[model samples]
Target: MAVAIVRNVRPWGGAAADVVIDGTRIREVRPASPAAAGTDGESVDGRGLLALPGFVNAHAHVDKSWWGRPWVPYGGEPTTQGRIAHERAERGPLGLPSVDGATAVLREFLRHGTTATRTHVDVDLGVGLRGIEVVREAVDRLDGAVDVEIVAFPQDGVMRRPGVLDLLDAAAAAGAASIGGLDPAGIDRDPVAQLDGLFAIAERRGVGLDIHLHDRGELGAFQFELIIDRTLRAGLQGRVTISHGFALGELPEPRRLELLDRFAEAGISWATVAPPATAPLPWREMAARGIGIGLGTDGIRDLWSPFGDGDMLGIALGFARLHGARTDGDLTAAVALASAQASPFVHRDLHDLAAGAPADLVLLDAENVPDALVRGPRRALVIAGGRVVARDGDVLL
Candidate 1:
């Protein structure tokens, strides 16, 4: 049976139409009918607002954020290793990875019109698999208002910490969508051993690998090559992703182009948080070569840093500003990278406001995609899985 009808909405700033929903999928989109508008509870009047697919957060850290809790001052060092030490020492006392913390952050994501996400949950020896469990319970608490794909992340060193591989394997076997790795060469100090171990586990468990490569310059480029070679060897093409690969934009032109070609051949994808200080990515070149790029809000108010707000629109704007997006087409593309173009990151074949796609969408009172990306006004309505989940910046579920 049809759940609801969103009447008189302009999809992607196009012609006004009526979007019909049935259960968890979009039934159809047809020309608006004057007689179809009703005050009944089964229909929602869109008021000709701009409708877009609900945002997809390609990369996120949802487990450790202390949102909705009393303010915890940022006392960690600036470097990567320093932050890791600080989190390990501080998280235990704060009761980090609790269901309440994860639920609060997820609610924020939903209130910002994000309907789905690919979140990295911590899986170290201290917490073991407890963090993953907390995140699962948090998602359930929302009654499926937000869809989350889990990545069992070894935030600490993987090779240096023995028995972590077994934990990752257990996570994969227990139905985690993918496994994550941190700076292998920089943190573990043994690039080959770390990469080989992660690849081995991914291959054996039939899961994907999403590694965090924070090593910059030639060191980072070298690790990229290793990942490409290993991906091809393990037949894991299209199943591997590199998060925060800051070196691709810093390499020399010739070397960078060469690596981009190889990356395309190996089906490697890139996820970035679009920090202001980093070099602009060669997004045009990567797009020409058919490489996928997805944007994310890394971590919000977490032990790592006191930044981010779980808003995908803000991340899209940062990406546009970083890449110097000016024209209308480029701005629209930037918005796409945050919504429709991010399907593969969350293992979705299709996530849009069209027929046969999941009925996940956001309605904003803006002129078009460019206006929405620039202003990022409160979402007038948010529908997930053919159900109304949020209204006017408030989460209903």
Candidate 2:
């Protein structure tokens, strides 16, 4: 029964209040009380800070991020296939002796106010379950500091590599929270079979689906339909997620509206790394339609591109800047894309800094929500599970 009090903080950049925590759950949220000063629990002074629900990163690749390694110029890849080839050629040989790289990035994520993330660990014929094993090990090591949802990601198309399903099954059995897939039409060349295989595994294993659907335009819409049909049939609805469904945003206005209706109906969600594109994602429309859309860093300084620093605040700002969000309302919504808006998609019981909720939160040196969004201030304190895990940009846990 460890008790703690976060005093004088503006929750969601609102009016100042004191959040009282009893062990792992928030006990109370009320105006500053003079009596709280004499309470026996630990007290974290939050003056001049804006408190927010800890950000949730819905899509990530933690196992093989080339984040801490020496810089390697991205090998030129004219097409998606070329990029796949370059990635396999470059990443296959990066031996894994320790979980140092992944741990380092997870620490950085905590320092930047992200307390939980869903990381896709590669599961393919080449690497088998080695990547998943190392990532799980890291998760175990950092259990209390950051919560991680492991996705057994078939980065090298499931059907393209024989016996990959068996490896994925093994990884899931070993404790992967979900199963993942690459581009069905573009990489596997068989959207129906690939989706069937992915959904079949998810159903059989009693897990969830987080497919990487990067196919563009009409082809992407075709794949999305197939996914929706399968999700509806299997009754997986809210349990299914489509990462990087960028093509849906590229469709004509009428078509996009129709499909968005279908997405809301099926309860399917979308996760984006907030990549800059010629045609922007219809995030505002999606939000209006009650669709669940979350943000992620995708690959943190990985072979894909030389970007990402595990800073969700910086990425939230990117989401705002990319979408031309200048008004206060727009900026607040952008920040929520990485926080409350994203958390429920991953786990319905998570997010929000309310009583009875887990005390997973961040206190930033900002006056309000809009200020936090525009400036991307450093975290003054990051509390996960009612414990101060990181303070002043240093990971105490």
Candidate 3:
């Protein structure tokens, strides 16, 4: 097997070491031997670079985002239903989000060192599978540069969209990896039926589940508990993820503790974009409870808001600052949540850095992991599956 070495890089801000890559796996990591640095193997001079595992975007709307499109102002109604209508209205005259647009967004993510993602593509009555098709094309185009998990998301209410359930199943058969749901209680208005339909589709399709929960306070808490119950009953413990679980912040201390325990018991995972408008989740507490917590950019510079720069580094910084995490330990934990914590919920091989880990690594121009999280430095190099896919903000492969 051909061998490649990244010499003199500080792995997670530790002492300098050499990472030996054999094909798609990291074969070895050892203290740097300057004398043998250039002896054999294909070498990458990693002096002054901090090597960390590539970021994993646990939740993102790959199809709904207007990343490469001409900047359009947020023209949707403030209400969720109105916004869904507005999104539907635009898809026709504007046409489905193009393959080029989706590819551009993926490239932007690569520039910021995100090597893997779980992208939510809309699968509803309005657009059917057009968005999923184009986004899947983009994902296929960037196959090795970034590994993406396709979530057949129902941006519109699943139960309200009649026949959307079959569409979701078709999306899975066509290539989607997971089934997605939106607001079983708030939007669907039939929590039990919505949960049943979602779980049933997931069961029938033989895929995982990712539900978007924007419902808040008591109702949100109820929906969350119900979903967890279904997950356990379906025996899909670690296979289920709740995105934008804002309800977790609304519960009282005692109730929150109970739910946290339940979440851990059911092996539930939560994905958050750390939006400023909502109550920030007690991330540290949930993490301690052994609940899987992952971070995302939600929607990029899309129609929802004029935020999101496709920078996972910046997102991590925002996460740390949002929670007032100033200590090195706290900041380090935030970084891990944004990157490695996603492994259990997504794919472990793609998000971890170990001897047998996939060669999905980011070399950033930072002295240490904490500094990278705080400063959000530019990526020096990005390697995906042992291939140099990007460098200095440019996509190479």
Per-candidate TM vs. native?
A: 0.98, 0.95, 0.95
Residue by residue across 1-397, what tens digits does model 2's lDDT show? 2348888888987888899888888988998766544424488777747899988888888876766667768776856678667778877565532387788778888899998889988888777888877776777787756888889998878898989888888877777889998899999999888899888888888888999988899999999899999999998878899998889878999999999999888888888887776357888788888888888988776667677889887778887887889998989888888988887555747578888877888998887888887778888888988887888998876
By TM-score: ranked, best first: 1, 3, 2
Which candidate do you rate higher for TM-score, 2 or 3?
3
Instruction: Please report, in order, the local distance difference test score of every candidate based on alpha carbons.
Output: 0.92, 0.82, 0.82
Q: What residue runs in model 3 are displaced by over 4 Å at the alpha carbon?
A: 1-3, 36-41
- Per-residue lDDT tens digits for candidate 1, residues 1-397, read 1247899999999999999888798989998878656547778888999999999999999999998888999987889999999999999998998899999999999999999999999998999999999999999999978999999999988889998988998999999999999888899999899889989989888989999999999999999999999999999999999999999999999999999999999999999999899988999999899898999999889899888888999999999999999998999999999999999999889888889889998999999999999999999988888888889998888
**Better candidate number, 1 or 2, judged by TM-score:** 1
Per-model RMSD to reference = 1.2, 2.0, 2.0
- The stretch of ten residues in a row with the least summed lDDT in candidate 1 is 33-42
Q: Return the top candidate by lDDT.
A: 1
TM-score of 1: 0.98
